[model samples]
Target: MLDDETPVLDNHLHLDPDNHRGIDAVRDFARLGGTHLLVVNKPSWHLGVEAETGEDFRAVFERTIEIVDEASSELDGRAWPVLGVHPGLITRLVDDRGFSPDEARDLMQAGIDVAAEYVESGEALALKSGRPHYEVDDDVWAASNAVMRRAFERGAELDCAVQLHAEASEDMTEVTDWAEEAGLPSDRVVKHYASGRLEGPIPSVMSEKDRLETAAERGEPFLMETDYIDDPDRPGAVLGPKTVPRRVRWLLENGRDEAVRIAHVETPERVYGIDTEATLERA
Candidate 1:
């Protein structure tokens, strides 16, 4: 089992009090030896916020900060907010809200700007953005790419990391090129739900045995996450909150000590610029 002193951090997770386990799920993670989490904001519609403009995203970002505060105060888990426009929301804006593709693109960029403001204020540590994972028309795809590029720009300006939610792939040269052009290092861009063997962006590999081993074998910095959605209906659709700590314990039992420390401590510190040891002491 992972020792009590080890700092096990989940790179991506969500907590929703209204319809899911919320803080209790975080408590569960803590009970299993998880020390910290990057609590990304859920989509606006999920929180019942009908965002009509970039300023309207304030509600979503505020709620995310609120949730992070709640988790930090009420549980042993240490949490930070990663706020941004979810790429899939572009479709919601265009199809359901009667926005043109260009309009949706502009609004999403505005949302990224708002998220950057949070990062600048220190309420959030990182940004999140990516194109739709599913197939779409060429115009929608182009708009989504535009939004993601804006996110990179904001991340560059803020000098913070950007967590990406997009289709799974081993090659991300195109995305990496955009980050380079935006003046953000490609390593500062993380691919959520990623597996090992990716070519460009840092891989926040899912907390699975084989994937973790593959990422470790890559011989570079990487992080691990469960991507727990915290939805009661779907349950463990992506993975459960306890998965990270438990997987770390499994790795420890198998004598993968360096891998555990590199993933849970070193990579997070480098990517997010947080002191894992200090956070654990505070926790």
Candidate 2:
């Protein structure tokens, strides 16, 4: 069983109130001992925002903030907003909106700039950006990388973490270089949906039983996440919201307290610079 002293944080998650379980899913997490969530913005298209201008992304970012606020109140947990453009949206801009590769990249950078404004104003904690996860031509790939670099620059400026959504691989040295080039520390960049194969950037590993066990055994620092999509049609697609806390509970029950503390307590404090346990105590 999870003790109240321990804090369980989901490093990356999404909640769409109009179309999914939303706060109800958060309640499930809190019930299972989750105490903090880094709620990220979904792609603009998911929110029905056709971004002809970069400012159009405000709708998605604002909605994400609203959802986080609601989750904070509805559950016995804390929720922080992480706003940014999803790299896959580049394809949507090209195919659906007929944007050229360069134009799409520029618009995505502008979107990251707008998200940075939220972080500047303290409405959000971090910015998210990354290249396309799927295969693409050289030109598209280059443009995607440029957009990700822009996100890194903004994160560096704001002194906040940047959650990345990029290709899955062990060697993230290339992405780490981009972040360092932009003056953001490599450790401040979080690799979402990670499989523990990472260099430089911090890994927000999916909370699978074996994966968690391996991560604990290695004793390297990492954050845990469910990456819950919160889509009704694809219910529990990536992972369910209750996963992190339940997994943490199991780990705790199995004498993995030190790893749990590193993941839930130390890593988040170092990466995001927020003391969730302190927040919980104040509550």
Candidate 3:
């Protein structure tokens, strides 16, 4: 029997149309024991380098909304959706349009406004790909922060949480500072991909043990994620159906369990927004 007090939340997951297992596969995963699954919507055009375009960007956002609408009713509160303009796409949009920094910021803000409505309806707002472009020095960084600020202001009113993808320790710190400045509760903000940096050409890695240890020392409660199985064909990407239990075991072995929270299993309740009663029945 499962312990009543054991906590499990799949802090990161991708449920786009391209998922090999399809939505039903994710649903089955959640039925096992996933408490919460944070789902992200990515633009189809941005899925690969070839399909990227301004029209495709908008199409992706629209499709993401459609997907959420379909899944949310079935999943209920079990699935939390985070909507945002990915940094990589933002860079591409800027480069493609030849827009000045100010123009780019305005465009991104517009995207956030549209995304906020979805969040206001109970979906969480997630700012994915924070490091590659939204750093202090980059022009897009300020724009990205502005987008976050808008979402934060709206989310605060609704008691919603905003999820952020942190690529580097510095990026994590920057995001934390921004959240603090906005007077947003730290607990309301969840950072994704907390595992230590992995050695490779890919941008994201498991966060270093020391980094997580330090966060724990400071009494910060952040979410830890293992975004395993990046498509080698598509560089700079991460897909789902994570090795949850195995990753959790690794953390326990390293004595990092107390430093982070792990969701060992993902069920439909967590991944697809299924109803609790239904989730329990499935479990």
Q: TM-score: which candidate is best?
A: 2
1 against 3, candidate with superior TM-score: 1
| Number of the predicted model whose lDDT against the real structure is largest | 2
C-alpha lDDT values of all predictions: 0.88, 0.89, 0.48
Give the true-structure RMSD of model 3: 6.7
TM-score of 2: 0.97
lDDT of 2 at 34: 85
Which portions of model 2 miss their true places by more than 4 Å? none
**What residue runs in model 3 are displaced by over 4 Å at the alpha carbon?**
1-7, 18-20, 24-28, 31-35, 47-62, 65-77, 123-138, 170-174, 196-220, 228-232, 235-240, 249-282
Clashes of each: 0, 0, 17
After TM-score superposition, the amount by which residue 101's alpha carbon in candidate 3 deviates from its true location, in angstroms, is 2.0
Cα error, candidate 2, residue 143 (Å): 0.5
**Per-residue lDDT value at 160 in model 1:** 95
* TM-scores of the models, in the order given: 0.96, 0.97, 0.65
Q: Report the number of backbone clashes for model 3.
A: 17
